[model samples]
Target: MWKEAAAGASPDLEFRAPVDAAALAEAERRLGRSLPGQLTALLKETNGVADGYGTDIVWSLDRVVEHNLQFWSPDTFPGLYMPFDPLLFFGDNGGGDQFAFVLTPERPDIFVWDHENDSRLWAARELKDYLHRSLLGEGDWYR
Candidate 1:
């Protein structure tokens, strides 16, 4: 399931997950944001991001990266931007009204829309750093 979702199909570049109403509500309350209708629908159908290698399965608020080496180049493989775990961001922000989650087969991170700069890449290192920052509330550290 993870592999299929990660490297599967779709022009929209989105992963679906079953909607957990309670979880969604709780996340919204925590993050203080409202989710968009389209995103809500997507979540109702899909569960979470597909974990590459078919081992790590990120749930509602978690995130996973799928790296495609075929098209990856030094310039493209290790993207500069980093993607966030929707579960973490949305859960923290309550729930965003806009659709923010995105996955790329060419990059080693997830791409998300930056309200300030439009969109940016969230590398795996950044993801780890963000996770650690959120957990420790200290400096940055990539896993």
Candidate 2:
């Protein structure tokens, strides 16, 4: 089980899931982009929720898109389903500047969706580091 301390809330959050190679490949095809190698490798090893101490964050690929089926991808990892404001992390660029964090079931790093910029940024450290320092802090609005 992978767990991390929530900055907004002191309590820890857990994200879990199982790795599905077929689904991952399909997600890559749907998104028309290859996932980071490290992320792919991690998914191959651990096929369960990969965040928090005991919380179930990441859902199985098959069970991931219940809330937003339109945006759901069988190949993509399911998010822990936390209710954070996406507008806080994503900018207003007519949906082009939006992004989402896809937590894998195997590792702590996150897969980001830079919709407006059309790119993906993989974290070198644990996802918590990026979330705590970059996304959640009060710095220049545009970095």
Candidate 3:
């Protein structure tokens, strides 16, 4: 899905190497939570879409860990106000809005965390659907 939206003649859309299982496992270990299978699988295909790809930007594995920890860790001051179990941001709108998945109960449902309004809206229920919409540029969630 993202492989196309993220693909382009431009250099910014270049695909990164797939994340190694050991690294993904280590991330999970550090996070103490199992990553969504679909999300992990997608990342395993390509770490993430490159920069300047709008809301479709899929952060790299290192960025994933960095982002999550920056927002989820108490040691990081001014961290995200909420807890990590419920929200794990993976993409950005190139603005401030964030796209994330809820993990407390372990569902694949995706949500948009609006930066302006501090609202969480359900975007898609499955990773495939979300990726399709993203590739097609069909949703308002990105902006």
Candidate 4:
């Protein structure tokens, strides 16, 4: 059902194999936060989403770790990402901006951290809605 929902929205719709507990655990450790239930379930189903039709990718576990460790640090590279923000980046908009879960909430909410404007704003109420909208390119997010 989840795969169908995601694939139905994506243009390329490439899916990956399920990942193991250790991989998931490592991802959490790398991100330093527990993923939301829905996101955890989704990761177990497909470690990531690769849209073959030229779009953003819902990062794989390794990619997640790599991207986080790369960006979520102090002045290591050129970007707006900061170490203090309690966000676990899960996807990229293929334009340097990212999507992540805001960890402050009891149930993590989705937010778009704009790389260009250096602003963080609410994007989706939950992971599912975020994925669906992202895959379908809804909401005119560039505004």
Pull out the clashing pairs in model 4.
none
Q: Give one digit per residue, the lDDT tens place, for model 2 in 1-143.
A: 12333334333433335367887788566544455453344345443232233322333443332323444444453463332322112112122333234433434444344553445555326533443433333322224
lDDT of 3 by residue, 40-126 (tens): 988988987754444445677777777887778776645445455478888766767777888877788988887766688887777
How large an RMSD does model 1 have? 15.6
Model 2: weakest 10-residue lDDT segment is 85-94
Please report the candidate that would top TM-score against the real structure: 4
Q: Between candidates 2 and 4, name the one with more favorable lDDT.
A: 4
- Report how far off residue 74 is in candidate 2 (Å): 22
lDDT agreement with native, every candidate: 0.36, 0.39, 0.71, 0.74
User: On residues 1-143, what C-alpha lDDT tens digit does candidate 1 reach at each position?
Assistant: 33233343322233554758887676556545444443354455565433222212223542311221212224553555343333222212112211233332322242333434435434233333322332333222111
Model 4, backbone clash pairs (residues 3+ apart or across chains), number: 0
Q: Candidate 1 at 118: error in angstroms? A: 12
Error of 2 at 21 (Å): 1.5
For candidate 3, what is the lDDT? 0.71
The best candidate by lDDT is 4
Please write out the lDDT profile of model 4 over residues 1-143, one tens digit for every residue: 55776877764778889888998898888778777777788888987886765554578878777876766676665444455357777887887778887666555678888877678888887877877778767445635
TM-score winner between 2 and 4, please give it.
Answer: 4
